[model samples]
Target chain A: MSGHGLVLRNICKKFGSTNVIRNLSLNVIPGEFLTLLGPSGCGKSTLLRIIAGLELQDEGSIAIGGREVDGLRPKLRDVAMVFQSYALYPHMSVAKNLAIPLLMRRLCAWQRIPVFGALLPGTASRKSEIIEEVARVAKSIGISHLLDRKPRQLSGGQRQRVAVGRAMVRHPAVFLMDEPLSNLDAKLRVQMRAEIKELHQRLGVTFIYVTHDQVEAMTLSDRVAVMLDGELVQVAPPQEIYANPHDRRVAEFVGSPKINMIDVNVCGGRLAEIGGQVLPSELTIGQGTLTVGIRPEAFHLASSGEPNSISAAVRLVEHMGSDLFLHLDLTGVPDPIIARLPAASGHIAPGNRLHLRIRTEQLLLFSENGQRLKQQASVTPLREYAR
Target chain B: MKHCRLSFRTLGRHGFLAITTAFVIVPFIWMVSLSLKPPEEIFQASFSLLPQSWHATQNYIRAMTASPLPRFMLNGVFICAVIVVFQILICAPIAYALAKLRFPGRHVFFNLVLVSLLIPSQVLALPLFILAYQLGLLNTYAALVFPFVVSPLGIFLFRQFFNTISDDIVHAARLDGMSEFTIVWRIMLPMAVPALIAFSIFSVVGHWNDLFWPLIAVRSQELMPPPLGLMAFKNEDTGIDYGPLMAGSTIVVAPLVLVFLLAQRWFIEGLTSGGIK
Candidate 1:
């Protein structure tokens, strides 16, 4: 089957008086997995639903495979969705569930007779073809043994596989998944993540995944669309999102042990007063008040001749297997600064006074209005700190 | 002394349960006993529990022949079946719409249905009678079954049950490329089966026992229901010939009791699920 790309143009959806999606636009490449990532009520799920044609937008246009599908019914759209709850038909066996889309496609209306269909003319071959196709898909998903069981009889992970198997049987042009792995346990979620990634590679079909989990988006998506308050803020590959965020919100949202932001003054051609302590960024931003964004890993244990070491008292020490997270209380800083160091460095403890250095190149500078601060290409590189 | 006290406590507990059971069973037992008694001793205080003479077959024959009981029962069955099916078809869609669909005037329409529930059936009887007369449907099965089929009660129950189901299921079906009607038919309807069966029992039993609508709507003696037929039978078989009327009455009550026993589990679950509130 040929792959299809989807496009949403100036789409705005409103529910009653509330505007859920505000003039959002995005383009999906053929045979790519794109994820919409945001928190609850952030319109990520609503945006996905709008794309599926399950919901109508108040104003905008949608195109699937380069054709406008404004008034087309959901059945005519040729998109398969894997739901968070799975939504398997409770009355039907797993095989029957997989056969439904094929049946709707291949069988004539009159041949859908509950009792006479098998005996009817020209129906036997079609029925067997559909059944064989369903079996093939079930086997591919490793759920061939569960073909006869009802959904309720299956475990959560098995049910998820069946859901994927059902979607696979049709081989629709686009697959829309709304948090399909959220219901699984932690281990199952991780296992399913890899399976789904491999499934995308094997099928090479377009997938539009919606989730509130950042890690899922980072791991699973070829491109991630970051949404906030129903608006598309940024869309980029995973590494670019973490290393070069477009906005201050993106930098803070995309990392675990979130990025530390401190208010600063970009005064008189120099970086001054980083939370009332002088900082060394040599090339200054525009002369205005700004905020400095620093990832926890960007800070290191200070040594002699480090350009921007700030002194602080350690408030708490947490030893994870690979690293130690230090919560530090500096004299001028309003909030505690966090530092992540190698676990082998066993030198830090709670209530100890220490000097920690901020890696200059890794520093993220933001404008006062939460916009990222850009610099010229000639900035100094800290080669030893690179992971 | 301790043994005596324990015995008394156990006796009190069993006595309370036995008394409550008797109270629940008494009306049913009395109906059966009354159906068996001879006409002359029907109201007598010293009447024997068993009949002085057996007229069981004879009473059944008279009940059939002396009145239009057979025709009335046939009418009851036809009317009840039609109403039950119509109630499900009509109420299920309305309930599905109110429960799932987002549209203008939904809250207003739901409130109107609730208001209709508050107005007692007796208050609507005159207006309904006039409407039936105006439509020239008087004395027909349509007059009895049409208006009663769109039960506010069934809609309320189905709506409540549908609300318990997550909307994500509908989205899943939609993305599977199923039409809205197909989604309702294939997904929501199956999930709402327990509610539907419960509502069916209520509708069937209600229409089976109702006499007022049939009495007011049907003028032909042949179109009467079981309850109305029993009333007419009681008047014609007066003066110690109570056997036929009692036999007919027993027949009328038996089906409901049997149906309840057969569906006892579902019936209780339905009632507690939908009606306890």
Candidate 2:
């Protein structure tokens, strides 16, 4: 069977009085690894459940491979789901768990009754075929030796692989995973992430992965949809999301050590004042106050007054082996300004006064309402703002 | 001083435990003693712990012949089995719905079920008797088994067990292209075995010993359960033949004790998993 792309149009879901997903629409291209990246309570898992037919959308329709699948149940959708808990059947052996879907498909309804099942005709041939298929999938996932073991007998990582194998045996067109790696310890999480990525490539199936981990989204997905409070805020490539975040929340949510944002008052023209310093004119003044975003890596230690420089005292220094994260105390800034510098610089120490030279091009400016300011081409990339 | 203090504390704990154990064991010891004693010694003011003479076989024969005890035991077993099977059928699906299925009024339904938990079964006795009378089910096992088929407590316990099961298993089964029914049977039910066994013990013991419902529902001697049969035997003998009555009571209690001892591991495991949280 060919892997089918999925399209969700204006999907709306509400849990009683609370709206979890509001008019959300998305598209998953065939054979593409798409990730829904968001913080907890962002409704990413809810959206994936809707696509898999595990949940129904209150409004709008779902189409798989360009066919409306609104009324069909989960089994009819040809979509497989790997759950965060690794939902291995506890009593069944690994091989039996993998063989269950095939058995359901091949065996007639009456043939499945416990006492009469053995008496049914063609069961032996069908059972052997399912076992063969299960073995093949188990071997592919390097779990052939574990076929006789129950789910609880296996370790966390082994259970996860078996969960994937159980899904893989079905050869579903689209695979829906809900935080599949969240249960693993950090080291195992990283290892399993690579294995899932490789499996996706080898299987060439449409993968819709959901995770609250931005790092996982960035590293594993070809495209990422950032959701917040049940709404899709931005959908783009990982690099684009990192370099050109559409909203202030996206910028804050996507990075480690987080981006530092400061509020600024705009005078009439493109000039804005921040921290009692008269900044150069690079943006046309909008209707209201604006917020400027500065990434940690954008800050550098400069000797004296530069075109874009701020004065501060070193509050703390965190040595990260190859890099140093400096926490600087600014005069008017409410939160401490963080800067990432190369370990070789060795210029920062707690209580030492310093001048922070910021790469003006790398600086991002946002409106007071948290919308990104469109940058003009002529102005330095970081300094420019929308008219 | 420290050693003396520690020794005193340990002695007090063991003393308390021994007293409690004796308190629980006294009634059982008396019942066995009465079962072994002759009628004349039972009414004596100065009581002995053991019987002067053993008439265990003779008492058992009279108890068996005095009432339809063989039939009564059969009735108890049959009613308990019917209740358990019906309870499983009715409660399992309802539990699945309460635990996993999302629909309108789910919390309201759940709260209503919780309300039922607060109300004791004794309160329902009169209404159930009346309902059975109206249905013309009096003197039949239907009256005894029908009302018990749907146990609110069973539903609540099974629901709690089902909820503890990871939703991932259900989702995985769904993606495996298994129907909702298959997911319930193959996925949810297997995980719910411990709960089912726990419910069975609750059901079997509850129905086996119950005298009130069957007492009210059935007037015929043939349909009476073991407990009611013993009650009938006492009434027929004018409360004088203590030996046979005690023997019958002993017979009635043996099956329950044996069953409990045999399945104590499963019973405790199931209870701890399903009830103790």
**lDDT of model 1, residue B162:** 76
Measured with C-alpha atoms, the lDDT of residue A207 in candidate 2 is 91
DockQ of each: 0.62, 0.73
For candidate 2, the TM-score is: 0.89
lDDT of 1 by residue, B240-275 (tens): 576677788888888888887888777767666665
Q: Residue B81 of candidate 1: its Cα lDDT?
A: 95
Q: Write the per-residue lDDT of candidate 1 for residues A270-347, one digit (tens) a residue.
A: 645553345545555557677777889987776634554667789999888899888989776789988888998767
lDDT of 2 by residue, B29-141 (tens): 78888888888878889989887777777888888887888999999998899999998888888888999888789889889988997997889989988898899998898
Query: How would the docking of model 2 be graded?
Result: medium
Candidate 1 chain A weakest lDDT stretch, 10 residues: A376-385
Native RMSD of candidate 1 (Å):
4.3
Model 2: DockQ score: 0.73
Off by over 4 Å in 2: A273-282, A286-288, A301-311, A330-334, A376-387, B1-24, B61-68, B105-137, B219-221, B234-239, B272-277
Q: What TM-score does each prediction get for chain A alone?
A: 0.93, 0.93
